[model samples]
Target: MAEISGVVERIWRYPVKSTGGERLDTVEVDGRGLAGDRLYAVRDGSGRLGSGKNTRRFRRMDGLLRLGSRLGPRLGAPQLLDPLGSPVEDADAFLRAYLEREDVALAREDAVPHFDQLPVSVLTTATLDWVRAAVPAAVVDERRFRPNILLRTPAGTPPFVEDTWFGREGRVRGGVRLAFVRSSERCAMTGLAQPGLPHAPEILRAITLAHDGRLDALATVARPGRLRVGDAMALA
Candidate 1:
């Protein structure tokens, strides 16, 4: 193993894809990813999944972000909440009302994975600080990037340090092994306004101009274990 590159700063899990997620202090990890992350997603009429960008399998339904979801009973069934922070009586109806789309419904992942790319997305505080410096007026919050693991680089570390981890192996202190697959590509979702942040198109613009539209690094769990906040990450 290599020297400690950083410490885990924050952990997040999105029970429902494309919606607000819940922060965690500790979580289980497996080959799939953080337990229950993006396990469910809103499916459109044509069987397209809801997301921040339009792709062959995903539709750009930004309104889905207005809703929030957390794991309910069964550990995978997500309980959708309204913008006012109240649990919705009917998830599909609530989604229809908020999104104004008649054919959308909440659904779980089937044979296909719900993640945009790799299962685990990792971001670092150093990169966030760099974005803040690049766009001083924008609210460059970590929530905007929606990373599953937020690593806090040591003081004075340069931004995008995680970039070097791609194609390498690493392990978290708690025994979770990972392979940094590739750099996560940024999309319009980073600029979309969510609960505590405002819509700032410039945020995406700055990333595009400076980083070629990529921000975080994507990884896949190589060994199943547990991860806790404050755990150290060592590249191998």
Candidate 2:
């Protein structure tokens, strides 16, 4: 008893996580990810990714805490630099400093590093509500989702609905088209204990258990564009 509904709400990017977010008025669409989202990351000698699924192994790596603010979508094209604006001639040396350990160099100039999977990430209000109701303890904010796009769909729709979005594009007013991909898989990161949140996993577990063992979110464009707020999402 449901029908296709346009995006009731959407989020275009993140300014700082574990802190606050910068809601966009409109954004461009790209393949790699939102026009300019998480272009740079802070990885130390301890090469590991913080994917909202696991964290026990996170100790090996450090300093990534700063990436949330240091990265730019392009960082002036390629050559990803730190927040301080230094040329990372040796990304290893640049990142290893935080580990206070040694360099592993898991990053790539041609790929997205320190990120869980794709450059863009997404989630839904419905799905988030489900998680909150189940755990009733953790702080399940968009930071946990780390998504560039946060969708609010028609009521009663399934959670992690991105899987159904393949071959479809979320349009904005009439300027850009942000497409959707398959569902994201869940991992131990989602179960991790955010320094202040005790019941974080109980919340994530709700989604994992509800939707088989996968995490649900959305992905968008990689190129930058001029997207206006109040755009309409139309599946193509």
For this target, which candidate reaches the highest lDDT against the unseen true structure? Answer: 1
Cα lDDT tens digits, model 2, 1-236, are 22344463666564322212346756655555554454433333454442232364333232332332333444342342454444456655755664454644433333433345555665777676777776676677655655566666777876556677665655555455555666677654455443333335565567667777665544556234555544445666
lDDT tens digits, residues 123-234, model 1? 9999999999998998778989999999999999889888899888778878998899888788888889888788999999999999899998899989999999999999
**Relative to the true structure, how large is the alpha-carbon lDDT of every model?**
0.88, 0.51
Backbone clashes, each candidate: 0, 20
**Residue 6 CA displacement from its true place in model 1, Å:** 0.8
**Which window of ten consecutive residues has the lowest lDDT sum in model 2?**
13-22
TM-score (C-alpha) between model 1 and the true structure: 0.96
